[model samples]
Target: MSAGDIILIPNRSDNYIYLLRCAKSGVTAVIDPGDAAPVIDELEKRGWQLDIILNTHHHNDHVGGNAELKEKYGAKIIGPTAEADKIGGLDVTVAEGDTVKVGELEASIYDVPGHTAGHIAFYFPAVSALFSGDSLFALGCGRLFEGTAEQMWHSLIKFRTLPVETRLYCGHEYTLNNARFALTIEPENTALQARVSAIETLRKANRPTIPSTIGEEIDTNPFLRADVPLVGKAMGMSGATAEIVFTEIRHRKDNF
Candidate 1:
């Protein structure tokens, strides 16, 4: 079966709420609906029935609209089993390796706990779309609020193995700022420099700079380049382990 069509819905300052619709089955799922009004309105606009509420974590910004949407559409809420009690209205609790279907499409759940201990991500192999809530961003990674730098690094390593063509659908519109921080650590990276130029134009136009390909991120994101000699050298850790370089870079970004 083919994967569903996806749309990014801008929500609450910088967060993105993803909407996935199966063309063949006409089933629709809203991912990380921080707010209900916009989602409700959008469903009405498309005359689509909301069938699922897919959450990545327990953060209020990610699960705030759970009750409202569940009440409104009787949508089944699927969330991380680790945070089922924290995230209200969950109908299915999933963990790593478990799969959830969106109409004809199937998404594999991954435990990417770093941004939060219970944070997870959904990956649709058919579409190569990764709904990386707070764990991974375009040119950056998530802050260590509930988890540690070590945990975050390990979590990112899992993503490093995904196909280069995979598309990253992260939660925030933090690419512009992340690009600036990345340039500081890898000033001579031509790929990042080129991406920064393009990002500047997009920001000037008030456009989104996300849904970046995994290949693009591998070439540009400093976090994803921790193993590269230049990136490690930039942090004065040229001989350090990849994990060490990753930790240091994350520390710098924490203060950036």
Candidate 2:
């Protein structure tokens, strides 16, 4: 299958809505439509019709446009099975191990519950794209809103196992803040420092620093590096388990 074209649509402060078009089948889908206006505008601009609405969670910023988009284009609303009630207008409720098809492209669903109880992510290995929503970010992870640190840690671990080159498409544009917080954790990390510099340049130009690869996050994101001895040592928990180290990192980020 040919790789699909992914377009970034910025809306509602920092929220990101992705419009994807399958190259081979010409099928179109929107991932996490935080607002209908932007999604509708993009679709109309491209002369494309929406076929599917993929929601990662029930957060307002993620599913707020579901009803409108569905009503307008008769798009199929596919969302997490656990939050089917919370996410109204869901045409298909999916869980881990299920596969969702967007035209000729197929995505593997992962039950990534941390930012929200029913949070999930879609991974299209063929294209090396992961629509992570709020579960993971460019240089950070989402806050533990409705889940525990342990749950969030495990959820991140799932992402860590993906191919190093997998492109992560998260829900928000929090990379600048996340990069600053990450510097506080690993000031000595040259890789992190360089990434911070690049991120600074991107933010200065008001460009999105998103679609960060898994390998980039592994080398720089403090949350994803909780298992590294350097990260644990920096937190004064060198001998502690990864979960314990991760909890501390999350706590500090909450206040940072």
lDDT (C-alpha, whole model) for all candidates: 0.90, 0.93
Which lDDT tens digits does candidate 1 get at residues 78-122? 999998789877899999989999998799988988899989999
Return the top candidate by TM-score: 2
Candidate 1 — what's its lDDT? Answer: 0.90
Candidate 2 Cα deviation (angstroms), residue 209: 0.2
lDDT of 2 by residue, 122-222 (tens): 99987889999999999899988899999998998898899999999999999999999999999999999999999999999999998899999999999
TM-score of each: 0.97, 0.98
Model 1 weakest lDDT span, ten residues long: 1-10
State the weakest 10-residue window (summed lDDT) of model 2.
Answer: 1-10
Error of 1 at 131 (Å): 0.3
